[model samples]
Target: METVKLYVIVFDSTHSAIAAETMLKEENIANEVIPTPREITASCGLSIRFNIDSLDKVKNILKQGSVSVNGVYKLERRLNEKQVEKLM
Candidate 1:
């Protein structure tokens, strides 16, 4: 199966988003904090997107730590030939 590349995770608050980032980093998970993409509805307007492979572990961490993530989505961006070629 093809590997999924993107994710959008919404938090209950900006502080929770930041805390989640710190926790993920401490556990050696790679991710980024970004404004909530239009596709997702959230009050905090901040979220974390990380590699798809880390989805389960990240969700577990959030649940265990009481970090309320409103939603999660798998996202993919189309790569033009030039971009695809560069990666090859």
Candidate 2:
């Protein structure tokens, strides 16, 4: 199974979050704006998740647009839950 990491980026406003989403999509970078997790307090309560490898590109995109990123976090997830269950 492929190991994956989730990078969450918080925005200062819903408009910024939404605009960021659009810009990311336009540039063909994989990302989605989701409800902020309970672990973080943010201005708009919205966050975008992307792969760690793609963070540099994402940062450049945000910078070009003057988007304010409030915070970022890394989360780990197992990619093969079904395989693990079979072993059990």
Candidate 3:
């Protein structure tokens, strides 16, 4: 099986998550608003998942917007196993 790597931006609230999703969409960035993965102990239930290449753009949009962020995380999945790490 192949490994899948992605990054997730955990927001502080649902509103922030939704707002971030909109901002990313406006920039033509590919993203998905997913339930905050159980592996990440965050305050909110929503997170935006995007590819590594879009990290900088996502960060810039979040910084420019009023969204409250918890942190950024790196997620790696291979077969039935997965790894998670806090990057920010």
Q: Highest TM-score, which number?
A: 3
TM-score: model 2 vs. ground truth: 0.73
In angstroms, how far off is 71's CA in candidate 3? 1.1
The best candidate by lDDT is 3
lDDT of 1 at 80: 28
* 1 or 3, greater by lDDT: 3
Q: What is the TM-score of each candidate against the true structure?
A: 0.75, 0.73, 0.88
lDDT of 3 by residue, 1-88 (tens): 8898879999888988888888899999999998888888865888888989988887888888888899989999899898999877
Record all residue pairs in model 3 with backbone atoms less than 3 Å apart, i.e. clashing.
Answer: none
Q: Model 2: per-residue lDDT, tens digit, 15-75? A: 8888888999999999877897655664589988776687788878887887777766765
The local distance difference test score of each candidate is 0.72, 0.72, 0.88
Mark the regions of model 3 whose C-alpha exceeds 4 Å error after superposition. none
Flag clash pairs in model 1. none
Model 3 accuracy (lDDT, Cα): 0.88
Error of 2 at 5 (Å): 3.1
**Model 1 spans with C-alpha error above 4 angstroms:** 1-5, 77-88
